[model samples]
Target: MRLHVDERHERVLALVRARGSLRVADLAEELGVSAVTLRRDVEALATQGRLRRVHGSVVWPGAAAGAAPDTAAAPAEVRDAEGVVAGMVVPTLDHPFGEIVEGARDALEARGGRLVLGLSGHAEGDAEQAGRLVAAGADGLLLTCDRAPGPDSGGWVPGTGVPAVLVERAAPPGSPGADLDHVRCDAAHGAATAVRHLASLGHHSVALVLREAADADHLRAGYAAAVEALELTPAPGSPYLAPARLPEAERIERTAEHLRALAEEHGVRAVLLHGDEFAVVLVPRLRALGVLVPEDLAIVVHGDQVASLADPPLTAIAPPERAVGEAAVALLLERIAEDRRGDRGPRRHVDLLPSLRVRASCGAVLRAAGRA
Candidate 1:
């Protein structure tokens, strides 16, 4: 019977002894087991007096005063299959990417799992957040990164050995990076499609106005490629790439003025703004400058966040935010199950395409591009 018992229980005891008092979360992650399983093991061990539980911490037998306290036992899996505790860290809980967090939470809940959310405000604190999740005994990690490390960059391998799935991030196709599961929208295709739509509108002097971001490189490359493919000429200094989001209202006004000059001075007719929020703010500024949208300068935004809320209703390239988040959670849960069973198999990476939602902003006859 002893030999037939789960080998993981023995490993848990050994680890606790070695650490002189290891947190339950740490032991769970190290064993690649669920928190619920750890609770059962800890309860059994406590009965045997092999270890002492110290107010959510674990202590070695005969441990001195002031022994290290550990985390409380996490809930056990509800059913036969292993339950996953996924940790997700994104830039913010506001517009744009916030919907991704909601979608991920919904998906995890549907699968009888939990999510631990963190905010890093871009990639600034992503590594730190990852550490916290792992230390908390997350079974799987769903990360939204500014830039996914490529194959040569060691490929987003978490030091905690937790399986990672990237949401709304890009990685080189077919590279060793593909070994990690991912879900993202096709940035290039989204930009190219928007440009093509504008070109079809007979706008020859097209320009791009984008605030600098991690996805800017892909947008730039796609815009250049689309211009060449369509035999269209970009207005001089066509892609006005800013170093950051125009923070101050004064900065936005300055940008609007510069854009107005570019339009009249250089015959620029159509402009693609980086996102809808900017378009919402800049359109009024353009009106203040006597620029009539769609009549004088047609506008398109790269993201559809709150686009409909704008005065004119914006045409936007809608990132697959919610879809990507849901898919990431699904993939991460799959990886968690496989990993628990010691099945280190091939990886999965998924890239979703963005769709253009057209409205008054782009002067579309119908709601979308394909409308008859």
Candidate 2:
């Protein structure tokens, strides 16, 4: 073969040069590749004699110092195959999921694909929209089903003979004959992080504000595990399920008031919101109720942007939303190509890990220390 390096190899080399040094984890995070993928690329590049791979970082060949490295172009396919095909259905484009949908669409477009999106106003209406999108010849389906009304909610995978990928939620238990590929963030990790964060801040009692009843048992189990891991008891007599009805603005306000009352009764010092809209509505309402954020009480909102900048800003657990979208698309394409090959792809799930992006609205550590 001619002496040449692949695009991935070039990227690893470039990042090493730019950062002077990098741990594999950091490189993988920055380049949007898996650590396994990064390692292979680095090994290949090292073999090419273009870079020297150390424990975690790579170095320029014969370079005296490890700074001021030149930039290398990312592969055209990697850059381009970032968008979805047109007319793909993206259910529930609100707040956190909406951000995911937009990112997924852009990613597909980058890859010369199109996304034909649809919205389901209510859980009862999801099946109809899903069918409609499939009938309209959507190349693939990208669904955000975490907020779906129940675990047995139907129509997510219409019998369109097209590949279906569930974004941000695992495949619901015990109800599927269809080959549905799943790509979801590590919600358990995020939830556990929230619990530990609150506990570390001296909050003994806290509540998780959820939107709809969880049809997925995994979520319920995860919640229990998190509570136990944090060495805190679940709110006494608190319901383990999500709300049964879709919450209106007035209802959300009422819920906040109810939560504050419950917090007071249970001696809860903090609240970690599982639902984005709930967090958005609760912040101002909590302030109105004279429950100062991170002062008289603390809050850690789960999900993304909606929470991060709500009014006073929120301390939140942010999943790798864009990365999840990217992975989902990648999975779909693999399945689609296999379909063309008369080969059904193997059934599998992709679970992306989450990270914390701390911000203002939670508590000022200084405030807690002062109180202490």
Q: Which candidate achieves the best lDDT against the true structure?
A: 1
The lDDT, on a scale of 0 to 1, for candidate 1 is 0.73
lDDT of each: 0.73, 0.64
* Candidate 1 residue lDDT tens string, 1-372: 233345766787788777667656567777777778787788888889887764344667876433443312311221212256898878778765787887777556544567898777755477778778888988878877654455643244557588888787755666544556778878888889889999887877678877766677678787888989999977778688654645658667877887889788888878888878878988998999988786678888898878889978888899888778777876776677677777766777687889988777776643344575
lDDT of 2 by residue, 72-103 (tens): 24323333332335344454665557667766
- For each candidate in turn, the TM-score is 0.70, 0.66
For all candidates, the clash counts are 3, 25
CA shift of 262, model 2, Å: 4.3
The TM-score leader among the candidates is: 1
How much does candidate 2 score in TM-score? 0.66
